[model samples]
Target: MNGKIIGGFLVLSALVAGAAMYYLQVYAFYRPVEVSSPAAAIRLVSLGGVQEAMLTSDFEAIDADSSPLRFRGCFVTPMTLAMLSETFETYEDPTPLNAPPWFGCFDAERIGADLETGAALAFLSEKNIHPGVDRVVAVYPDGRAYAWHQLNESAEK
Candidate 1:
């Protein structure tokens, strides 16, 4: 009877720890990013290597202090793809990071697939936003856009 009690206690303790870990990783650290925040700006790197703010609207974003890669934003841009491509430096590789499911606007898998098929184009928002991490924006032809922070080549090296 003592052994049974000990085994059940151990199992319950393990289950509780696992649940707490999941909650902390997926839900605890993130916070809604306000429009007034600098992280909310939808800026792109110009051909001249300057970061310029683009005209964006309906912006909704979330970020976490825990990691630079935790930023994810969804917005609408009035700028056409043609104008942007001609003006901004295109990001050769844009890997969207997964956002917590509660933040429904940003979908990393869909954005990544769109980029791969040329359904969307990725541009450098800001280089080295956080040491080796960069801010990348991916836009569809219809002006639907998303942004996320990813590790740059320097970080990889």
Candidate 2:
């Protein structure tokens, strides 16, 4: 009876270990993606109408003309993407929903950061995202924009 109990325990342990490994390898690791440049993002949005580039650390993206309610759209950087992946490492992917799985954690206000843009750009280059700089486009009221240009695999989210 003792031997049977030990055998059952071992089998349970193995199953648990296997599940842990699968989650760690397949889901936990951050799979870096190459995001498009801010210049490109600007250009894409400009196709609809003239758009402005906001990358300096001194000022946040905003429209002084009106009471800024929300950003119309966002041009996410590779570094920012990495940050999000790390931030939501354990978050369950909101699948079967049409919206972005990780959008829940994204804050548009954070993207206007000029102070961290420099550091973030450096990190982006190391991750193989070329011309790592402020590839930021903040959509304000009356601002024209394009669809989000992400380089990561959608299924991963």
Candidate 3:
């Protein structure tokens, strides 16, 4: 009886430890990044491919008043990631998602409806248009974007 009780306790403890580790990792790696200001947001986005980016005013109604700058892309590149990390201010996010292959994530104070809508759709879309999207970007005022296709790795390995 004593041996059986000890074994059960050990098993339970191991399971609990495993779960705690997973929770911590998910939150740490996938937390939203904090930005210092709107300029930082624009500067970060500018470093990436801007050919597909649309002006917030032209794309949506919420950002009509914010016309001091221009936006041109939805995603950022490795060349810009390091520069962006330096440009933006990030902190510990209270909540994070549980997705596999988490590359990184950040929170933006300002963003347009189009980007938010598109990113959310990508996350919940039926078709896997952007597979390997492990990281997420939580936009303020209810917006979100997830990063797919990590740049650290090569396409043809």
| Model 1 lDDT tens row, 1-157 | 9999999999999999999999999999999999998889889999999889988999999999999999999999999999999999999988999999999999899999999999999999999999999999999999999999999999999
Candidate 2 steric clashes: 3
Please write out the lDDT profile of model 3 over residues 1-157, one tens digit for every residue: 9999999999999999999998764443333223333322322122232212211211110111222111112343332323333444321221232233332232222222434443222221111122322122322322323322221112223
Maximum-lDDT candidate? 1
- The 10 consecutive residues of candidate 2 with the worst lDDT sum are 90-99
RMSD of each: 0.7, 16.2, 14.8
Evaluate candidate 3 by giving its C-alpha RMSD to the native, one decimal.
14.8
lDDT of each: 0.95, 0.29, 0.30
Tell me which residue pairs clash in candidate 3.
Answer: 32-106, 32-107, 33-106, 33-107, 34-89, 53-72, 53-73
Q: Predictions ranked by lDDT, top down?
A: 1, 3, 2
Position 153, candidate 2: lDDT: 32
Mark the 10 consecutive residues where model 1 has the least summed lDDT. Answer: 36-45
Please provide, for model 2 over 1-89, each residue's C-alpha lDDT reduced to its tens digit, 9 standing for 90 to 100: 99999999999999999999876643454222223423222221122233323232212121111211121233333224343223322
* Candidate 1 vs 3: which has more lDDT: 1
Return the TM-score for each candidate structure: 0.98, 0.24, 0.31
Off by over 4 Å in 3: 37-149, 152-156
